[model samples]
Target: MSADEGTTPSPLKPARPSMTAAMRSSSFLNDHQQYRPPSKPDNHYGIDTVVEDLQASSINSPKQISPFNGIPSPENPPTIVESGLSHEYTHPNCTQPPGLTTDRLIATLFYKSTSPRVSNAVGPSSSPPHTASSPVRASSPTGADAEIPSNLAPSSSFDTFPLEPPTNDTEPLDHIYGSYVSPMCITSFLHLMSTFPLPRGSTNLTSAHRCLKLDAASDHHPQVVELTLAPAPSQDYLSLADLRKHELIYRFEREWNIDVVLRSDTLWRRHPRLVVFDMDSTLITQEVIDLLAATIKDPPDLAARVADITHRAMSGELEFDGAFRARVKLLTGLSADIFNQLRPVLDVTNGVRPLLRALKKLGVKTAVLSGGFLPLTSWLAGELGIDYAHANEVVIDEATGRLTGEVKGRIVGKERKQELLLEIAQKEGIDLEQVVAVGDGANDLLMMESAGLGVAWNAKPMVQMEASARLNGESLLDLLYLFGFTDEEVAILSKET
Candidate 1:
């Protein structure tokens, strides 16, 4: 029955193969029977064979044809398929699906690939041999065909990119001297004034007489008669009591006057080598601890306590050890991070830049022997270009990043300040006679006393009285005169600065 049916064409022809199945079979045959050039000049003839025959020949043959060129060879030339013009190629058996575009390919190469071309230039073997066929990705943002926001981009936008000048006006002003100041100038001026010797003998008495006589004559003048004056003594001759009363009046006027000290250019000509400075209320206008307290969150009262301790210490009412310990205790649990955060807000005193600049020019080996924290003091020293600096370090908790409420190293007290001053002088190979110390508070007495020259700048009554020279109503530039800077030199500095 099957023979008869096959012989007599069936009503339905053999079920036509599905289009997909036919295509698949055709592709398979084409791949298997694909024409290959001869392997060598000896085997140059092309052989036509069916799929089965070609399969048998391929298995038997020791060499294959060159896919690149029509000529056959013993070495098979690699098959390089130009898949597309999209700057990407695909590999066979990459079964992880498709639809990857050029951009994705480039990004994947950048982030994932570590081939020679994509290797970091900063690597140990920086200069790798270049392969022409190896794909090179652009190293700069501009060369990339992608969008990136300005702020989100790296500061160095591109390694090879050109840089433009700053556009804003504030850029230049950022470097000006108004940026930072040192507090040493005033303290030094005040200390100097205190030690200045007064004219001796009855010169003081003669000055008193001149003031009294001037007053008496002014009282009798037609212009003076209209003005009020002490009643003319009823007796023609003056008694010792009258002279004493007159002397007291003259002395009161002299002491109270704002311009009490005379300006003498000669006095400043004598130069001083060593200068010592007080830290708080001297070099810097504000007590660092007090300012630090104010910056603390949620409590304002702590700032007051810090200020009190600072005042007592400066005035010598409390021993430095007791005051410093008490103050540090108040700051226990404070974060070390506060120093960095509050540095920008610290108030640098006025006239510090000019003073420090002048001192530096004079070849004075400047130092800051402060009672403040080392971090703050060191920062100031670096900023001001001071040669030497010694200050106490605040002990900080490594884990919690908080202050331990204790100083880590030596306490820079009155005695320590003096010691540092001597140490610095000895190290610099300078004698004490070549040194000058300046400070505004009682804590600075030891340093001031040790220096050959001591100046007080806007100091307390006690400090002012003890200092050898006092500077009032002048910029710190005047200190240059004390270091032998002439008017011409000062003018040149002012211009250069």
Candidate 2:
């Protein structure tokens, strides 16, 4: 059989009308379609239109072609049925043309909708299915195949690709997956996902958990970590609450100390010379008059009078002279011998010895400017090796050997304290800058202000607010450092004392 002779006669099938044939046969085309020699093919089809037409033809063509088999009949032309009934079918191995796979279709649609160039780089695999053994299967109409579990099936391929889990072994205890399923898988997923570049460094569950942990541990939140020690311009100017918040734990010689802050270097470098101390509640723990009164007859009444005067004088409410005079008049005719009897009961302030001893060795002259009487001040000066003592002298009549209800010298009021400081400075050839004053009373304000450095020692509120420095938590020995004394210097001073 020759090729032409062996060919079967074409079947004489009934004509089925085509829209193109009908349109061409009409009056419109009869006039327009007169055969003219075709001009050079007009390049009128747009690039996009040509591409789409080529894609459509390719998609409709059979997968295999053979010359021995005549042109395929329309009924038998390789049928390209979608994997599922709907266009949204997903079944592995189902036949489809190139670029019609679910992934490609999704990507193309996404690129068209968003106008972004879709990159072809493969992203992380979806999280392993809950039942790892049951593999997923998906297929496009064009025969493209993909396997993804129903649970792992992507909502859309245009969605962000999944990330592998972290491999961190030290996972949080509260992790839901870590509590139940394979920890190994969770760890591996974390490690793989970490490599993916996420928008804000969080994509997978593990990274989200890590981010939360980091936020919890931040310094902005109140955790029990040591505070950052960066220097601020003004340490002394902080609010009371802020001062307490950043309080430092310090180790001095043989002592563990906690305080809001330490004085700056400049304060100690320019150390004061003459030190003035308030006698009661500052140098000594107890008011000597109150102790003396307790030892005297009608102790309760005398103690009450002494306390009243002390409170008023300390608060800056009553003039120091008026309060002192009133308290002294109550003690008038009380024996000068009472001080000797009550001297044993007097309690010196803590660390007073080391403080005074260190000051003396430093050639820092010390003074006790007290609202307390002269006799007590003189006695304390001798005991403590203080260089100067200015206090209210109780006038005692020689005939009676009892108080005469008068102060002999200038009253040790606040103004008088300031004056005495100036007078002592002049007498000793010392500048006011060479003076260190310590006090606990409002009456001490003038004296404190007069000295170069004023220390408020467990002071009243007014004094604490106004003083150059305040020492509340540590003993008087702590003042040694404030004077630029090192630990070794303190030890040496201790030995000398």
Candidate 3:
């Protein structure tokens, strides 16, 4: 089948900005350069498995919310200004029954629906779903006709507020996005909701599992939709829910071509004040060690040996410090000045500049905490204008001007990286809850866990499952949506530099 000819389009799917592998050539492009392979890879896993430093990851899903995941109702509507680069912590326009706690999920479900199963016309022209003051009764077939479980949450608990379809603006949009599943799959969603065991009982598709409050996120840019999941067991992540998410999300992604990332609501509201990155395979494309190994003249297989060790270390199969030391020992007599040759060829990951600019606009401090050696790490930090840089320092022999293959002070292993993160946060006076760390390997896990949000960027399956969140979109800028920024807001911030 042709790339664009998968499922039949729905009236609702075409208006979204998200698209498939075969993106339409933009009229705005230079006429000679308009037909390049689509910038956004198809969300389908087949072609999205791009060759990169890290292995293609295992499945990523939203962090499951536990029964204890409840928050207090706001005294007033949250006052937010998301259209600009404002760093305010306000969340606007939430109203639920007065004096009740609610479990929230800031779901960033994009418009990937493209099912052959047809539904009645629903588009930008349709009215927005009703708010809490006038919530429509839960009406999905599974909810209205399911076998009410014996241990379901009291229906009265969730009946006060009801779930509604996400809202969209009325402006007529002209662009057509690619489709994934039909909105009709909300049928499958309702079924999963009932089967997902709750703390007190089951969802049973009852009113208590209703979606209560809706966020005022931008509806035009294939937006984020925040909902207050009334009667949810807790806000904490649960193992069973995550296992089910892992087992099912992969199938749904492959069969239907959708992306579902679940994150714990633990750091949901805290916008970061500092962002840290692991340099190799994350901020930049290549592993510096592998590059060093390729330069060895005496040993023809030096590159292969070091590459094997580095891969194992990053994969969590080998202890990092031993793996790092083992690789460095192979380079006992290399000229340290090779860094100059290496520095010029390093490729920064796509979206680094725009993400940094947005963070800078928000007055966030930026850092690079790499496990590789430097002057290269420091050089990358300087090139990117990052505020702080830390990495392993190779000891140079005064007699020969070659690397002694020994580290100078302390090794920047996983534990050391965590310590550096805390030190940087303390020096900046930024609270731990306001720091974000991004990386692709096991060494990054500790620092990521300590930060307000830990983003696993095209991570290994192991890292994806452990980090605070996983990012697999076409570009890293998709990260802004995790913080509730819309695509338009991201576009504006990306234009800064």
Candidate 4:
């Protein structure tokens, strides 16, 4: 037979009805416009496999059925089938509910439906039967006459799905800052908290033995323990600034080298926009101008006189601006190469390099403000990769290549240091609270007082007494702990380059 003659419709297949009568009616297209055929049936028997896997996991792994696995309680049992065939399963342990089982697995995959039309949407009869697996299956509803699961009956009220376990997303923000007068000792953290008086205005501690809430799972630092202290109901909020007012705090500082660091939890959480430093003794061990005066070629005895003047100025015996001018005058007619000669003698303080590298990784802007001259400060700033440097300009005569004794511009003493800090903070679009100032002299006091956190690094008595914190240790890396950074964090930041 020919190909056309051989082709015939199967006897089992029904012919599609013509739509000519319905098409004649105007509302026929509009009325059935919202009608849609059911989705294609899922041609897999994965549900049986999932049920078997869950059964195996429950039996093989006892740890998987942990009581604290964030399952809901039995007092309000979860609906398993919702097909009116309600059954409750109690574990033999009875201490808690067993973790997800085959029934719960099925419940999770098949949501209960209130509408009869969708009630049996995914049941056995909805698709072709599977011969490979013998899993329990419900019958699908057939047209308006077909029955839905009785348990899936419509209710006036229904519970939404159980809420997911609380996450660690808010963990970092939930931390409480702790402050200590001295460097935190990891070994003595818990001991200190227990022995010391509760942080200021802890009126709630009357009933409780401890004032601070120590988080057992805190992972930041073992030495710098994370804690939370609720504000006293009747008293004003306490801050690190108010630390000195309490006699107990003073005793802690004097006796144990410990003082409460207030609101320390918030420090260094966000990267600061600017960090200002006093260049002389802060960045380097020796004062730059004093070093410059010592290295001047033309002056032999000038170093001694200038050294004495510098000591007096740094000790606050002489005013910085006048004393600086006097010391600069002693270098008059001296070759400008004095800075180059002192360059080899310059000693960067311990921990300066690592700290600066870490700060650079964090994208913090660093600058040095000094009463010393620019030639030395500029060179040091370049070596340290400092973003900005400001200092006094020593006028040099082009013919002699020597100092003329007259300053070319404004002096960068205490007042100017404060001004530069303010200008840098403003230019960088950061608040004063985001700025950290470090110094080691009486002249650095003004700038220190103006910054958000002032660190007196091996400073004179006056600077130490007034600054926010004092670091008597030789290492500058200790500053990391003050900002709530652990050793691990510093190490991670170190490798970024």
Top-scoring candidate (lDDT): 3
Candidate 3 Cα deviation (angstroms), residue 471: 1.3
For residues 231-306, what per-residue lDDT tens digits would candidate 2 score against the true structure? 2122244532243233221111001111222232233334667777889998888877677566556655777767
lDDT of 4 by residue, 1-497 (tens): 89989999778868887778646654444357687444323333255435433344332323454354455566765556677786556532123235722110000000001111222332224422322211122345544345433222221112311222112111110011221211232223334334434445343322111112112332221223223332211224333455424454433333332323333324343456688988887898887766767666565787778877876677666898899888878878878887788888889998898889988988889999988888888999999999999999989999999998888778888888999999999888888888889997778888988887788776765665667766665567656655655557877776645
What lDDT would candidate 3 get against the real structure? 0.63
- The ten-residue window of minimal lDDT in model 1 covers 103-112
How well does candidate 1 match the true structure in TM-score terms? Answer: 0.47
lDDT of 4: 0.58
TM-score: model 3 vs. ground truth: 0.60
lDDT of 1 at 318: 73
Model 1, 366-416: lDDT tens digits are 888888887888888888788787888888999999998988767888788
Ranking by lDDT: 3, 4, 2, 1
Better of 1 and 4 by TM-score: 4
How many clashes show up in model 1? 31
lDDT of 3 by residue, 265-292 (tens): 4443437789999999999889999999
TM-score of 4: 0.54
Overall lDDT per candidate, in order of appearance = 0.51, 0.54, 0.63, 0.58
* CA error at residue 492 for candidate 3, angstroms: 1.0
**lDDT preference between candidates 1 and 4, better one:** 4
Error of 4 at 25 (Å): 89
Q: How accurate is candidate 2 locally (lDDT)?
A: 0.54
Clash pairs, model 4 backbone:
82-151, 83-151, 84-151, 177-264, 177-265, 179-260, 179-261, 180-261, 181-259, 186-223
| Each model's Cα RMSD | 37.0, 33.9, 33.5, 31.0
- Angstrom error of the Cα, residue 31, model 1: value is 99
Which of candidates 2 and 3 is the stronger one according to lDDT? 3
